[model samples]
Target: MQILDTYLTKAIANNDTRIPWGSLKYLIGEVMYGGQAIDNFDRRVLRTYMNEYMGDFIFDTFQPFYFHHSPDVSYYIPTTQVDAQQQGLPMKEMCLGISR
Candidate 1:
């Protein structure tokens, strides 16, 4: 979680806006589960979170991919695939329409 906190701090410090909420949700989910497939989700979330939280502080527009982290040591495996699978879809869709 330290890595996530650090990234959030950087985004706050840079005053960058334009992060996507959808992507942010995905990122937080990924982080909590420890998945690396969509690790970029973290950068997307911070960018969006900063933008939403500190819009006026932004100096210039920046792309999401520009914020990169070292791949070698940062890669992580999520505890489960359930989180990624459930993202963006309703519980019904995620569960294939099985009655809850």
Candidate 2:
């Protein structure tokens, strides 16, 4: 977030805050998913998901952000941020799968 904030600050100073979508996508995918990606196929899938989620069109009001669009499991991006406390899920519930 600090790096992103610095990037935003620099862009603002230059009076051009338009984000470079391609670079943003690559950097985010590399940072967030690169280590977890086990193989070429995994990397390709990660890139594809990043391409879908990270784009300028995300800011368009008419564009619908769907993480997954299917008959069985449909998920969309939340319009507003919710506090962790407000979510009412306990820490164990939230991080259910992995034992720490």
Candidate 3:
């Protein structure tokens, strides 16, 4: 979280905080699936940090496919300094399985 937050801080300072959503998606997948990247916990942890701290600005920018799943792009647009409670939006998540 520190590493990502550091990058985020720098990005925000530079007025270029928008990050490809696929990167995050892959990160989550890697965490859950392992191998593709550094596996950590499930997507929930990431979602808590990103979606909570910074507003999830979703877009159509698709990242290069390789990690084993597809996800929409989300710009880290922090509208408030506090972690806003997830309201209104239904709680839904996409789960993928390892390919044979």
Candidate 4:
């Protein structure tokens, strides 16, 4: 999540929410996970995952993050997971949702 940290840092420094999403998307999809993908399908999956999980919508604190959602249950990050130790405050564990 270093990329996210860097983006947050810059956002704070500039007092702007407008991230260079095009470049960030490419960096996440190609530079980060692309090399680990075994094949074209694998690469596509990585790209899709990045598109869904990484976006400007994340800046909206009013909205809750839903990694997975259904009528029965929804997975979300807990507010208590915020880590102050990082350069840009990041959750210690984003997938810690056990219920609700």
- Stretch of 10 with least lDDT, candidate 2: 89-98
Candidate 1 is scored at a TM of 0.27
Tens digits of per-residue lDDT, candidate 1, 25-92, equal: 54455565435335677566545644443322233435222111365322222335846733633445
Candidate 4, 1-100: lDDT as tens digits: 6975786688789988677777788877887767888999988877777787788776568997767677865555556644532334334444433232
Error of 1 at 16 (Å): 1.5
Number of colliding residue pairs in each model: 3, 0, 0, 0
Q: Note the Cα lDDT for every prediction shown.
A: 0.46, 0.66, 0.43, 0.68
TM-score of each: 0.27, 0.56, 0.29, 0.52
Q: Which candidate ranks first by lDDT, i.e. highest?
A: 4
List pairs with backbone clashes in candidate 4. Answer: none
TM-score of 3: 0.29
Candidate 4 wrongly placed segments (more than 4 Å) = 1-17, 60-63, 70-73, 77-100
**Clash count in backbone of candidate 1:** 3
User: How would you encode candidate 2's per-residue C-alpha lDDT over 1-100 as one tens digit per residue?
Assistant: 5666676688789998677877666666776558888999989978887777788766677877664567855455556664543363345522322344
Candidate 4 TM-score, true structure as reference: 0.52
Minimal lDDT window, size 10, model 3: 59-68
Residue 54 of model 3 has an lDDT of 33
| Candidate 2: RMSD to truth | 5.1
Q: What is the lDDT of candidate 4?
A: 0.68
Candidate 4, residue 63: how far the Cα is off, in Å: 5.5
Runs of candidate 1 exceeding 4 Å displacement: 18-20, 34-100
